[model samples]
Target: TAKASAPEGEDRGLSIVEVAKARMRDSVVENRGQPQTTRVTNDEEEDDAEDEDSGQDHGPLNEAELSRMAAMLSASALVVASAGGRRLRKLHVDLNRILDGKGNSGVFLQYVLSRLHGIERKSNTRLNPEADLSVLEPYEEALNLALIVAEWHDIVPQLQEQQDPYVLVSYLFNLAAEIGHANRVLRVKDMVSNVAEARWFLFWAAKRVLEQGLELLGLQSVEHM
Candidate 1:
């Protein structure tokens, strides 16, 4: 079901959720490519015995607790998304680079989310979507993020057509990167009165979009690194 072929004039295909579930189990999943919804299995998607490739050593996976709940969902999603149509011979990769805040990986995005969480916590001011957003200036980064969030309405059909999560993953990564740039210019928690509230609303709005996208990818954003 990984690579679905639709009929002419049709956009049917296996969904990213189906791909994730199938890939995780290394098993067959329902294919959405056909009108009847047939079952298809791609053996290539199944993981083989674990072994580090000679050229790349992932080193030891961290002793940090591992579970589906704590499974670095954001990072994993990014990795999967980055893979696109290709399959990695091994799932292992350098965690250090993936988790680096200076990199454009999912971990870096999570770090930004943690920062937003800290700001909200320290400010002790609740951010509401309904907050006065008029005070927010048209910062390029913020506006860019707004445009991305607005595209959420268009994402479902694209996902349905492409049946690939790289689209979603790419969006999340870009949004996170933009928020990082916006944070450099906007100080939300540090300001007082309407400025602070307006800024928090902006951050909160971005946070909302990020969380929604992550949820669609079967991933999450954390409060702390």
Candidate 2:
């Protein structure tokens, strides 16, 4: 959720994440209050048509929806926790790349959704909560993933104490990337019998970890990009 104070005077004692979220939320609110005309170009028209075909509404977004979008935009833009007063000549905020299912945000959601879809297609049933991951014990990548998650918890406290969002975000990016690589090598979806079930549980565990990380950043994972 993108949290914002009620038009506060000073931003004292606010964490960097809070400040960013508040600014984005305020921007959305100000823009919504303005009187404006919208131009629908050819590409936009096509996009609207596609959305309509998919049973999506073309109506204006509600407050909650707007807040979520603002949150994601803020989270996506905060690449560095602290720059030591450094400045960039040009900073680009690519809304398309951020929202269109690309980059770290997209990769995180994509891995989660893809795993769910793959599991469903293979089993046609829910993942077995008690499925044994023993089949994955011998895999070096699997063990490495377990270690990454364990390490994440250990560093979280120190990272929070330092007020560094960059490290947390980077951790998620690496976690997602490693899972993707492991899936390619393990071919979890192509396994048979207990191996498939076990790997499904492993993937589910990773998905849950990703979801927890996204929640910490106040970003919601999407079912679709």
Candidate 3:
């Protein structure tokens, strides 16, 4: 009986050991079958960080270029104004003497004053009220006298053909000043040169004054002036 009982106890001890081992194996297998929690690499994380930093580092040169461009434009404007003013002054003197004078003074003076007023109104531009009217002051009497002396029956037609009465008056005045006579015939070249010069000067002066005035008014210089 003792031997049989001892064998039974040994069998029971073996069965308990086997059951414990089987439980441990099942627990380990179940844990392994579920997904693994992957460990992230430090090199990949560092590379991602570096990429983010690089995205924020776009170059550094916007403000300097803008300042340079503004300065260049201002310098260009000054040069144009200085050169233009001098040219205009020369033309004004030449044209004024040619167009304003004694003999045809009344008619031409009326014409000049009327034109001046019209131009002033249209452009809203005012001549200096106190500016010296020396060149034009005697135009009325001078033009009338010129008309009397210029007894040519076709005077009106000839003068009108010149388009701008101011130009014709200038031409007549210059002729009178230089020649001391009005009705004298002129060579074609002399006539052409005189008219051409007067027109050039007049246009140049007008452009200069307009630009200067705009500058004074705190406006940008017009591109086409």
TM-score for each predicted model, relative to the true structure: 0.59, 0.52, 0.17
Give, for candidate 1, the lowest lDDT window spanning 10 residues: 49-58
Query: Given candidate 3, what's the lDDT at residue 106?
Result: 23
Give the Cα lDDT of each candidate.
Answer: 0.53, 0.55, 0.30
Which of candidates 2 and 3 is the stronger one according to lDDT? 2
Give candidate 2 regions above 4 Å deviation. Answer: 1-122, 188-190
lDDT of 1 by residue, 1-225 (tens): 133222122213654433333232221111111122232334232112111111111122222312231345334533533543333333333333443335656555566666676566555567665666666656776677667767867876897788767677677777777777777777765477777777777777787777777677665666533
lDDT of 3 by residue, 113-210 (tens): 22322222223223343433243233453343334334333434664574433433433333333222211221111234343233223322333433
In model 2, the Cα lDDT at residue 199 comes to 69
lDDT tens readout by residue for model 2, 34-152:
22244233644534432221212233345666567566655644532221112332334333333333456543354344454444344433478777778888898888777776777
What value of lDDT does candidate 2 attain over all alpha carbons?
0.55
- Among all candidates shown, the one with the greatest lDDT: 2
Q: What is the TM-score of candidate 2?
A: 0.52
RMSD of candidate 3 to the truth, in angstroms, is 43.9
The number of the candidate with the highest TM-score is 1
What order do candidates take by lDDT, descending? 2, 1, 3
Model 1 misplaced regions, further than 4 Å: 1-96, 99-101
State how far residue 132 of model 1 sits from its true place (Å).
2.8
